[model samples]
Target: MRHLYIHVPFCARRCSYCDFAIAVRKRVPAARYVETIRREHALRREREPGWDTPLDTLYLGGGTPSLLPPGDLADLVTTFALNSDAEVTLEANPDDVTLDAAAAWSSCGVTRVSLGVQSFHAAVLEWMHRTHDVAAAERAVETLRAAGIGEVSLDLIFALPAGMEHDFRRDLERAIRLAPDHLAVYGLSVEPRTPLARWVARGRTVLGDDEQFAHEFLLAHEILTEAGFDHYEVSNYARRLPQGGSRRARHNWAYWNDAAYAGLGPSAHGFAEGIRRWNVREWVAYERAVARGNDPIEGKERLTPAQRALERVYLGLRTVAGIPAADLANPSSSRSFLAATDAGWLTTRAGRVYATPSGWLMLDALAAALTTSPEGG
Candidate 1:
């Protein structure tokens, strides 16, 4: 099955720590944007007639997809044919999650809403330069629930420069009270060129030290697990469900499964038939290319077999389902797995290998150790 991701790159304002390819513009031409995306979708289908697989998942991610009007959203959703039970998700911010908006979204085929609620503390929100207050976050959750959108996910951030243990615990408790179906908790990292980095460079704010961050991460895992959320992925947790119930985000799982996916709009990426392509990041350039009837792709790369294998290992280890035990036993790959296992960061049982909770925290290092040169020279 194939998956689809539609990127909406317009935001009302940029967050201090965001480094994604997003445009903070005062005015947005949503109609024109959606039309261009529809054209791109049609063009891809025309080029690859065999790309007619039923879409198992559809994700509307952004700068702020919620910023688009309800009618525009419905038009975009109608452009694609999705599976009967496709996991359709929309990423929204608290300020945009009004009761009317939530109702409109549900009617437009959005079955899940991932709210960007970084923190419930006023200080944290201010420090992050988020537009919504704590009350707004709480109200948004209530509004979504009232609108009958139950499969909701709340996002939280920890490891702030001035955040204390008590603060982290309080934030987790506040989020749990909302009773969301899912939670995505992430650690704060000062990315290069972000506003946060600039502030740290000038001594306006300090960055959390490694020890403090690790402690906060471990605490978050312990608290959420105790609250009955399954630590399915490094940054994701979900309420325990009954047997054969839906427990994972289909769209995210598709990426881990290496399923074919088509991405539309500026800065979007697409992978099909071993060919990976990305559109130009500049909106004007992308629009111009599409207007001239030229492909909007800025670059493309064909993956070699070895490169694909490495990618499988790299992306697989980050999830709950680790590499198969048989694959790990290869002489070239066994050493890294064995080393990590010995360090108590990984465990092997039956035919499956998975990272321990600690292992997930250090996943990047573990994956790097597993990747080897093709020649083994």
Candidate 2:
């Protein structure tokens, strides 16, 4: 199924760990950006001539998508042809969520809201340079659900700075109590050129080690599973309803499952057929490219069969859905998969394989091992 992703690169303030392409704007340039997105889409439509297929899922991800007024948000998403029952999602900052904004988004046809709470603890929020406090996070959840949003997804960062891990359980427990439809817990990482990295370089901040990360990651998985949440992806948990059904993040699942998707805006990535492309990283460059009526995509690579095979393994390993065993029937790949299972890094059930918790911890190494092609097919 075709998916549409609109990237909004505006944020209130740059987070310490954010290395994504973003511009902190005092006033969102919503109208101009939306126009650019449409222009670029037209160019792509001309280039392909067969992109009129309606999108199955539309995701508005960002710097902070909620920064857009609901009317503009609607204007942005309506640029595409979406399926009748498409899953439309918007990512919002916890501090920005209110009854009015949530209600506006719901009326705009957003099926899901992914709140960027970061952490429910004030200290942790402060360390992460998040604007929202514990109370605001709680209120965001309450107000959002009351606003009639069908799905509420909480974004939490675990394996925090030195002292925060001690109270991490409290944050997890509080999130569970909120009863969100989905939870995405990410283990913190210090990316290069970010404030957190500079702090570590200056010996001002000491990040957690692997064991610390493992502890908190396992804690979240265990607690959420006991609460009846499905560990559908390595870092995502989808809550099971009382009716015994679940709704996965359709947009992201498309990525993991290697489906073709189109992305708009700066630094957004898209893939169709075997080609993977991304727009320019800077706002200025992307604007200039789009203004010229040419593709803002600065780079693209066509994947070979082996490369796609490796990607399938890598993406599959990062989720509950493992790659087909037949995909690794080659001698080297089969040996690697067998070795991974022997070391308790993977498990097989029915016709599929799943990553164990330990496997998730060493996921990269495991995927590489499982995709090691011997010469050619």
Give the Å shift of residue 206 in candidate 2: 0.7
Question: Model 1, which residues run further than 4 Å from truth?
Answer: 163-166, 244-246, 331-333, 373-377
lDDT of every predicted structure (CA atoms): 0.83, 0.85
- Candidate 2 local lDDT, residue 220: 90
Candidate 1 scores a C-alpha RMSD against the true structure in Å of: 2.3
Residue pairs whose backbone atoms clash in candidate 2: none
Measured by lDDT, the strongest candidate is 2
Q: Write the per-residue lDDT of candidate 1 for residues 1-377, one digit (tens) a residue.
A: 36888889988887999987787878877898899988877777787664577778889998889988888988998788878888889999999999898999998789999999999888788878888999999999999988988589999998888642238889999999998889999999888899998988998887788887788788888998888788777888888776733356778877876777888888889887788989998777887888777788899999998778677776777777787766543633566666788898888777777888888878877766666633211
Residues 1-377, model 2: lDDT tens digits: 38888889999899889998998999988888888888888888888754688888999998899999887888887777888898999999988898888999998789999999878777778877887888999999999989999999999888877865457788889999999999999998989999999998998988888888999999998999998898888999999878886768989999999998888899999898899999898887898889987778889999998789889888997888887666666533466676778888888877677888889999887777766645212
List candidate 2 segments past 4 Å from native.
Answer: 330-335, 373-377
- What lDDT does model 1 reach? 0.83
CA displacement after TM-score superposition, residue 169 of candidate 2 (Å)? 1.1
